[model samples]
Target: MLKLSNETKVGILTVVGITLLVLGFNLLKGKSLFSHNKTIYAVYKNVNGLMPANAVQVNGLVVGSVSNLEVKDKDASQILVTLTITKKIDIPRNSVARISSDLLGTKTVQVDLGNATEYLQSGDTVYAATDGSMTDALKEQLNPLVQKLQGTLSNIDSVLLTVNAILDTTAKGNLQDAIRNLNATMRNFTHTSASLNGMLDPHNGNIQKTFDNLAAVTGNLKDNNQKITGILDNAEKATGALANGNIDKTLQQLQQTANNLNQTIAKLNTTDGTAGLLLNDKKVYNNLQYSLGNLNKLLEDLRINPKRYVHFSLFGKKDKTKPLPSDTAAVQQ
Candidate 1:
């Protein structure tokens, strides 16, 4: 091989460098020099940070790239964009392309392949859309978490405020008062428990004796149950008899007797009956006393002078000539 001069070598190197630069620039803009490419147009209201060189995907696989973007109508709010896809891939006429965002905010184009039998020609207009933006997606995903975090923070703040309030002097005093009241209640409960325990103590015997007595009484009642029932039956029969008008007849008779007694008492109180006169007449009492005295005197005189009053003789005997003082007084008169 023949060697060139320095200038010619330099010129060749510079051209090669410039060619590499051009190729790199084209690659950075999503152009492939070695592949056949097809261009398609789309309209969107917003591209959402979609730029040229952004990847184009069909069914989640990278197949092409976004090549251009433009504002088609400011008044209509339409944005036109161009996609460069591999010419070998047939896109259906009814396909739509949507711009999307990744976790890193890098943009992409996703094509929704359609079932239409008709295929799209190169340079034809396609449908376009975008799923908001990276920030919007992040907000959508994190909203509930953020709200929960805010609520947790609010609860923590309230708890801290409560702690601060509880640290105050008045709160301390109230707590102390509550403790004192609790202690007092505990003491009262202790006293009550002691009193109850004393009453229940086995050594006291009183409670046991009372229970034993009650048991014995209950046993006796159980043993006499038939007798008691018989007595109760008799009482019930008597009550039945009284209920059959016997009690009314007896009551009537008792009332008549009471009326008679009342009338008798009234008459006796007025000195109309014999008992009343005997009880009330002082003159009759005096006459009875005087007659009793006279009878007593006559009995004594007869006892002393039986011969003067009484005479006797189956055969006539000589009459004694006894002269007493009363006989002589009578002769003189």
Candidate 2:
């Protein structure tokens, strides 16, 4: 190495010291001097306290830092921010860089990833957004609730005013009476509920006893299940035999017999046969009645005068006596 003067050595040492100091200060402020990072841009209406060197996060992981911020328009209404991402991750073109603040009021740019296949390149502009501050968010959330409360208060005020207007002496008395009746009704309902509870008591209730009886019946049925099954099997076999037998032929014969009987009865009713004529003709009935009466008289006379009907003696002696007048009259008739 060449020998250097004291002034040159001192100047070089001072320059090195200054550079090292600058690097250390930037590192402490979350900036890497020799980082392999890409630069992207975002425009926002407000940064919400975002500053240079603030952390740029993707899903809460710090991947880079905000590099710069500047106003975009002459009116200073929009701000343009520069971001440098050190992480070698693809950020989509439609990704949002939202400036969000923590509870401690420190702000960072949170990248909400999008589903675009085309990714951002160096100097690309991402969509920018600003999350509401804590106070602003609370105000936003409470606005509708406050309005609802106001409306409810107004309705309550109107109701109270109308009630005050309507509640005169008689109406107040009627309301009191109605309240008393409601109380009485409530008491009655409570009593009825108590009675129902007692009636439904498991220990000493009729319903419980009925349920026990029903359970006992079911138990009895369960005990006789085999016998009942056997009876049912016998009944089924009997019915099957009847079904497999000539039941249709038997029924047809019975139906034919019944039809013949009905036809015979109809013919009897119309005097179409001898039996029908005997049942339906009055002259034949009268003649049969007269013949039966005469036969009965003749049998009665023979019973009374047995000597006239039969003669039996040891000697063949003829014994004759004058017949009775009633017998003669009967014979003449």
Best by lDDT: 2
The alpha-carbon deviation from the true structure for residue 209 of candidate 2, after best TM-score superposition, in angstroms, is 1.8
| lDDT of model 2, residue 83 | 92
User: Which residue pairs does candidate 2 place in steric collision?
Assistant: none
**Residue pairs of candidate 1 with colliding backbone atoms:** none
> Whole-model Cα lDDT per candidate?
0.85, 0.89
> For model 1, where is the 10-residue window of minimal lDDT?
318-327
Pick by TM-score: which candidate is best? 1
In angstroms, the error of model 2 at 132 is 25
**Model 2: which ten-residue window has the lowest total lDDT?**
318-327
- The segments of candidate 2 whose C-alpha lies over 4 angstroms from its true place after superposition are 1-174, 307-333
User: Per-residue CA lDDT of candidate 1, range 41-68, in tens?
Assistant: 9998878878888999998899888888
Give the CA lDDT, 0 to 100, for residue 20 in model 1.
100
